[model samples]
Target: MGVRFSKFPLCWWPSSIKSNLHDMSDIDDGNKNEKDHLPGFTEYSLDQLRSTTSGFSPDNIVSEHGEKAPNVVYKGVLEDDRWIAVKRFNKSAWPDSRQFLEEARAVGQLRNERLANLIGCCCEGEERLLVAEFMPNETLSKHLFHWETQPMKWAMRLRVALYLAQALDFCSSKGRALYHDLNAYRILFDQDGNPRLSCFGLMKNSRDGASYSTNLAFTPPEYLRTGRITPESVIYSFGTLLLDLLSGKHIPPSHALDLIRSKNFLPLIDSCLEGHFSNDDGTELVRLASRCLQYEPRERPNAKSLVTALTPLQKETWVPSYVLMGIPDGSASSNQSLSLTPFGEACFRRDFTAIHEILEKLGYKDDEDVANELSFQMWTNQIQETLTSKKHGDSAFRAKDFSTAIDRYTQFIDAGTMVSPTVYARRCFCYLMNQMPQEALGDAMQAQSVSPTWPTAFYLQAAALFSLGMDNDAQESLKDGTTLETRENRN
Candidate 1:
């Protein structure tokens, strides 16, 4: 017979909170002011929400666990045809209506592109609900673990890491750093297929103690010891997320660390991503994850540092939402369309000579657009500028002028058109030499993003993490670097 596990509480509030219930009226007023300032937030009537959810029909239930769960979530369509996800707190979850409203309002005030934007809330005498923008692509868990079609691409996974870190950074900046349940399920994919952190995690529950819906192994050590989560604890959770992205399985942190120590990451990586990522990219991500999973919360890198570390791993920060979602372009006869544009086809094929011949024959010799079309002129110009800047930066780097190298590389990066991995790697090295591990990590990540297969990026990242005293992560990076070198030698 299977052992049935009891449902965990949603959140923990102090026992004294009930005694201070009268003061909650003042809190409600403050929440009102917050709600007023929150541009898109709304106080919806109970009837409106009920109607939208088709009277909370079972068919509307969308929560991963289903309607019987403690806090049920439903996908609903509003009268205006706006799709939304509504969370209906169990009656016992928040008995204090005022407290619930105040908490909801506080969370509603938070706004960021990475967050599933809260749209409205409802608080009747015995009913409480929070509504957020409906995510079309489902939760990250479904795509990562139980994908029905194709698995998530390596590029998309890397992008998710950067986006998630930025989201955490934004939340940390907004003073909402303590996420109640931070996990893959908390990440939902919006209409554009971009991952978004669910805002429901921001709301504080009325339960008297810390809650854990997941396994204790995944919970931060501090939460197990003190039964409370801090900002750094959230960072710790973020580290677990990195592990999730890398492993594609729910391995315990301790076990993961053991695997890292053993240099046994090959088995940890998902089979679906076998050839999708380079050894260096995997190693760098693992190392960053190890830092986040550090036993001491204070020792973990902050959200900003995490953002810097992950930013460079992104392949294209501005990929169209549809492409990220893997939605097929509906345009008919794409091959015929391509055939009509010989210049474009030639450019796509990287046949510069053919492109130039076509442009010259088309009588557009002087036009900048034609010039660019002829020989990828814009990219060529940007490369020339990048090379010039990189040369100066390389000179400074060789001369032991770390600061100047950083400055020159900063200019190169600011130009925003070049995608040179060498520049990023050199700048990362300079940042490390100058004792700027965070910036070094960022540069290393950028290098990897620009050239995912390059081993040097991993080596630089490992060096920076080592300087920051993140030994496990550094070791992981070294392992990845070695793997990449081995692979390169074999080729």
Candidate 2:
């Protein structure tokens, strides 16, 4: 077997962290001096264990993680009488000290409810222990899926996605931290189903892509083949998580990336849901998940965009009075008719257009009735612009005018609109037509994040990933698409 050693590169560390890590790196390689590297232990050792790990034991085993790793975790009371979960490091050859120190340093700077907070570590001789706050419910992988577990409700599933993404953003925005690892088993679900990103031993600062195989579903085909830890790789993993949350499928040894990459992702929702969720929200979640899985790392959005994109899928928050002057156009009136009240009759019967013309001459675009309707203007000006460009882009795509189409669609997306999905869909279609498979998948996934119940959005993503040789994931996408198709037909 090939042996490997890992360290967060000094260059990648921010100045604040570099100062703290300098002294820790100086900790002599005592085990190496005393003897050769142990067969089962990693570079981590007992001497390097954190001081906070005063008391830890096997009796505290809270719950087993997934099949991905064999770290036996224990939830125990420290000597100080605080509750903590301790995970035993599995490597027998290298010392546990290095991993523990890395986690400690990471924990020292990172703090968010979405991420499990490290309580301490216990490294005595060969034994390595990670003491963390004990979460009541186990990891999300166990509950939402697993052999006999009940499926989560749609609301809970969306909450998990939002909370989990927030956690990733929390990590990504750190001065020098990113969740290089975000597998399902590492995602813990609280009683309310809010997620806490746990397990950091494998969480490395080095972007060299963990030099090992993980659940294939979480690894993009590129990473699977190249063994590179990249930002896009993390997005791929998160996208797999979205699939699992939506379909309740685990990342099998072979994988699940392709499974949910279909046009009919609606059927991927839990059957128990009995069709209870808002279509718009569901579509958004599925799309967001797919976007995170773009094969090319650069094409995927960073965590900030993800959070901003998924915010609409969350529960209602109060909008300030000033925030919304009025509802968007279509929102105010139904398809029935615009009955004129006495005041309205006076307004409409008059020379409104002529008055608007005068106002325009006076340099008041706002005076126009249509301009006052935010949704109408958005749909007409912005959405229509996107649609128009997208139509032109489609023709250009068939004619092999890829560069021109990409430019056209890019402009449409850059020009703001009310809905994220509208631009996402237009841009996604544009990318696909332009022969940019990665960009197609990225933008399509973004569209889904804005509207998950829509199978078309999901299917578009499946087509993109499939074209790029992510065979396993493509297969899954087809399956999800089929499921949604059947459901739509039944409807």
Candidate 3:
């Protein structure tokens, strides 16, 4: 069901998707049919596109580059006067006539927020051309690994890491296939300086049509031995990606190379980052990547979990792409970015106490102040993030981790945030679990304050009040209660 897999002297992905790669059989153009359409989306062919440029001619060729090997890239002018990249591979080398069409279809169908979009492909008899959005900066590999370019800063490197993982995630979910290939050579940095993941021609489609092939060398030991394409394989690749990011080098000939596993690899990281990187965080990320690259696919974290792990890093300050913009591959957006704000920098430095103090100051009661919505939401989000982290003073109160109950209510206090009384009543139980009677009472009161006409908040308030031994106030508040759900929940 997966690529043509074999384990002789350790398993590995075949050299070319067009040649050695199997199971990605010669798919016919007719596969694009009524049943094949993605959810709420339509499919298209090159004919539907405005037009395409044709040339093996010297005039149309913009530049020829060689890193691993010589790649002939052509320059074409679109109707919009935009110059695009077209890599015309030798068709004779390909195994099938329809393979190019399928590759085009697979790459073109993906619409990512963080990857370079595949425009279309021209199946000119034997020749196959993959047309793509013209990226000015070329590949991230060029700058990051190049001798002339400045070293990639720590934050910038992290942003690219997030973008790449998200791109792979998008590809994995879209075609129902695993991205078996995630080498640095495939990731191109655009003119706006954002890394755009490319090389989906080798992407493997799963049952749902959104997966990539497993790079055997990068494949976890568990999956390297199997023909299955699991997220763990991607995780293995992610670990390799981390190695690539830190070292600004290609993934080694072997699978599962970690910065921690080999001290030699740790020093291989990009020297341009001023050696300014988190050994702790990088080590954790490396270990996580290593887990994904485990001998078994079952040990790896899924893309969603990867997203959660990388979410905190997203909030930190990263250098803006000098003049480049990132493009979406299959999973990311055309533009994944961050700010260099002072407060953002402080958060990155883990100055939580300073941030907490700022929030407290902003929360001050000002009779003259017309509800500071932005400030309120900022403080609330901060509080929620704090409560979620283990280091936070409040996370110790989990009655089997029921923080979401209070989170929703706390969210309501944010400047622009608003929640119905029903939601507050739900969170009150969470506060009660944490033995936070005062906080529960506050949530209940805020719910009532937001909508005094809502009867449920009063019922919730009554329950909280009674718990606090304010029986008389609870009875008085109950006078306005009427909603059946609230009353039942309260009782």
Candidate 4:
């Protein structure tokens, strides 16, 4: 069992990996709650967040504007297989670190079903990043304006408005009155396709500066005059979003108001929604939007009032949002193996033979060094021994002598001359073969710490967790592995 990991570059990972291992311990001890909610507010280390997002790779970017945007968000998977959206701010965005922490901690205290809740924040040196729940279905901007499958249904639009209103109302009740840059982009759909307002807007971008990033047409009138955001300003932005949902495209508030005044409702309404709603229903929604777009911020209705008005107009309230959006239901899809990647499918079925075949085919591809030139470290005697141990381990693993593989791999690991996720992954597989699920799990988690985006590490973890009878966690790991594998293939 030892494999030469010298080909893989050595990395100085942060203590976040230790934190993740501690969390795993909690899970093993049954101390974690099984409910669908974040445990508590976390002040994550910058290195930890960096590892989760694969060093903030462009391939994992989820922001609508991609890398060009002032603030960029990337999709990341935690060691526990939970998806997170990490928003990295510009260097000078939050100069006051203490102020940023205060804002993030306050926002993280909120736990609302209508909001894509803040989970943590990272403030180390010049780095400032916020972590929140990741929405798989994408933003309202994608579904409402640039739909791929089909335009959002009328019932779903109504639900979006109501849920957003509820989210704002919840924030207001919590003494957090101001929301910055509220727009269709701030709205995202959860796994169930239900809309939830992004919690990122709840925090101030700077201590004392302008926060609005959208065009003046979408900006609240009061904000233009004073360069400030208030509760009523959020309501004004909500009205513009109403216009977006009513019409198929982005319309300036002034132009939409003009269309409303001329009673030219035909151009203002989305053509796809024509046969879906009654004239009275459209008129009622139009009336609400007009009220929200009033010239004076004080004249706009509060979040609760908007919620009340939109609630009655909701159609098919009993039906699931995923059903109306024509997306796959997460619960139903979790049981099916048809859409899983090859590695994920093997893990899901616990087919060790298939897993071994796939791993052998992979053969430390990610472990290859970037440069062909040799380094001074390569001449060290310790490096030679480490390479020898790994070579022996690989031979044993291939020959199905798992016990020998384990001993050789342990020697390489204890050498500390090199760090390789492939080594940890191989050792994890060996442990699994020896029927030591806990040992297998430790190695798998270690592999993730060394290389966060390695799909094989996640797949091995799934197999280990399944052997331990942690089927739910195993399924989650399988999903993450499948997603990462798909993304890798795309790139």
Candidate 5:
């Protein structure tokens, strides 16, 4: 038996939690942590990560450059409803597991409001992954260059520069002085639209030997000459980011410096930012950028100095980031809650009429495998029997015959000829309708087991948990379902 550790004894847990834990324990065997790590740094399992990210579906990918990126990052939701960003390194990226874990542990220890903090790492077998808090708004690249709503306001751009400087300063203070490829894409906006630096770039992909992905001209001068990254290299990269924020596009550091030297700033500034910033404020920012891009690494200002220089330049100090960016404030209760789907709304309102129509509209499409199998396996009596039972259960479900639906679904499940999450989900709703909260929870758990990433299973669990009076747990489950549903719709 695996050694299990819990802060509280079994008797201390609520009856609902205890029962759910007992029912789901067996399904979690493959998701156990491989080994313990530093305090507060979780060592997640491959299986758990897979389920959280829907087997790393391409549709859930959040990293820029798509498949071509050296490492791909996906957005996922944890069981407890926390959103996470999972970074899966390339197969050959981190060949040394020990080195990978050490690096992860070191970076995981440092946390601040300025960063998308690292929460966990998975290093089981050949897989190497890092998990961090998800930033919802998007990257600086999108907001600065590819904005849909509007160009990021001048005040927001200044805030980004200051925030990034503070983040680098925090890392530097924590003894992690070097940050790889500090670019606009490396900066992300959290749910509140506040900018935070991604922690993924803190860990070097050592095995690859290539550190910088962008143009060599934008890279630190020392790195170009010796192929080595230093603390000053990060500052040099930071200069490029300031230029990106100011110009609304990438400007080669050399070209930008010459423009600054000649006092010809009009061509370097973004047209979108024409009247937003004063000439004096613009000149001050340009001078700071020049200092960061000095030819000699030693002459470059450190992270602390950058923070010092940029602190006084902040605009709209009292304005919230969301307001400045023209986005909804995430802290607002209305924005915090996700908009429910039609089927989800029907379930939430306990509207049997709308539920029946949705079920009919959905039909067996959710169980396409079962429909396809009948074409080739009609001669097999077991397959035929299983399909017939499911059809009957679905009919009963749509007809609002909860008791009959339960009986038919039970028969289909016990047969073991076929497995379908949709069957378990439909039966779960039936159990809820019949006021069998425990049975509803059981069926919902089973549906999750059958299809580990399905949002419907989580939604069903929320309903059952609510009926059981586990209000907090029900809300968590509801949030998890909403998160998964959002990802599915994006696909």
Candidate 6:
């Protein structure tokens, strides 16, 4: 049987706990009325959540560990058909509904590309659930161990370390530094096939009891002694993760340190990664891992330091995370569908200099007539409406209201009036902020088509391309933008 906690009657609980439970009705009503101002977070009604998970059916449970546990996770599809993972906390896990909401809200507010963004939460009486963006790809554990397919590549492993460290850094920055459990299972892959740390790990331990699935040997020393976790303890766990990546198996930190001391890391390394990494690369990683595994919490380096150390060790910064994960490049087929005019063709190849030469040959060098012709083709009323919408969009964009910006920009674009490349570029940036990379790339392309010489267009294109896992193309586009910017400045 799964671990079980002793049941307690409501009368036996503390006054504060009882008060918290009594206030749940008010809290639920307030949350329902308030808009989810927090980006990447939502507050789902219990009915909405139930519909998503088909009443939390047994088949919906995706936790490899099992569903009978206090904290059970179910994979669900939202009403809009967006995939999500709903984590349901049993009554034994969180008796205080308010505490659960507070903790869930705190974690939900943390927004980072490296994190599996929290969609929302549900707190109604005894039911407490956390809804997070679903990851189609399984956890890092499945990929690292018990592999049915090819083993993870060395470069991908290195990238995962950097991503996880960056994720931790973001959480630390937001004052949610204490991760409940940091392990391979905590890393998940998104639709784009990029690895993201599960935000559920950010939830603090319950007042009722401490919880840890791994053996005590794998846990931090402080947690074993004091039953409390600190930020530094996270670093120690990160070290264990690094060891898992290197060895392809769970090895005790003490034993891993011993192997590192003997300079016998080759045996510890995953044989699948043989010949993929150099001796120096392996040595540097082992050294970093050793620092993280320090018995004393204060001895371990911070996440920022880990990022700095790992940055140089990354041999291919231009390779996108999806590519590193062996995901098939979707951008290639998308690129094929784009019907490129001559100028668009040049932009596609990232040939800014060639584009400039062609434009000059065509006698279109910043010509007033060309600008006027492009800028003045619409009726005054339509122009005024477009401008009004654009003004609102720009205001929203500047304020970081990406959803509002997207809606307003869509209105402006659909108005069918000619606008400046800057408008398209701005909308593209908003798309990027909203995690709509494909739409961002589309807008970037439109910007380039409208104004081929615009440096910002190429720059936005590069960013969009990089996000879509077309890194080589992104680099070329970035170079083109730099060249265009430098030339314009020189003139």
Comparing 1 and 3 by TM-score, which wins?
A: 1
What does the lDDT come to for candidate 2?
Answer: 0.52
Stretches of candidate 4 above 4 Å error? 1-35, 207-209, 333-491
What is the lDDT, from 0 to 100, of the residue 45 in candidate 4?
92
| lDDT by residue (tens digit), candidate 6, 393-482 | 877866668789889978887776644566676777777777877777767666666666666677677767766766546645655565
Over the stretch 353-450, how does candidate 1's per-residue lDDT look in tens digits? 55334423533122222111223875666768866887887678666687998899788777765556666666666766677776766666665554
* Candidate 4 residue-wise lDDT at 244: 92
Once fitted onto the true fold, the runs of candidate 5 whose alpha carbons sit more than 4 angstroms away are 1-39, 333-491
RMSD (Å) per prediction: 19.9, 23.3, 19.3, 18.1, 18.3, 17.7
Most accurate candidate by lDDT: 4
As for lDDT, the candidate ahead, 2 or 5, is: 5
Q: Against the hidden reference, what TM-scores do the models get? A: 0.60, 0.48, 0.49, 0.62, 0.61, 0.65
Task: Name model 6 segments beyond 4 Å from true.
Answer: 1-40, 328-491
For model 3, the superposed segments whose C-alpha errors exceed 4 Å read 1-54, 58-71, 93-95, 202-231, 251-259, 262-268, 315-319, 323-491
Count clashing pairs, candidate 6: 2
- The per-residue C-alpha lDDT of model 1 at residue 298 equals 84
Candidate 5: residue 273 lDDT (0-100): 82
Worst 10 residues of 3 by lDDT: 13-22
What range of 10 consecutive residues in model 6 has the weakest lDDT sum? 13-22
What does candidate 1 score in Cα RMSD to the true structure? 19.9
Comparison by TM-score, 2 against 4, better one: 4
What C-alpha root-mean-square deviation, in Å, does candidate 3 show against the real structure? 19.3
lDDT of 1 at 416: 63
Model 5 residue 378 CA deviation (Å) reads 97
Flag clash pairs in model 6.
42-119, 42-120
Clashes (N, CA, C under 3 Å) per candidate: 2, 47, 49, 11, 0, 2
Q: What local lDDT does model 5 show for residue 167?
A: 89
User: Model 3: per-residue lDDT, tens digit, 27-73?
Assistant: 32222211111121223234422243453455656442532223356
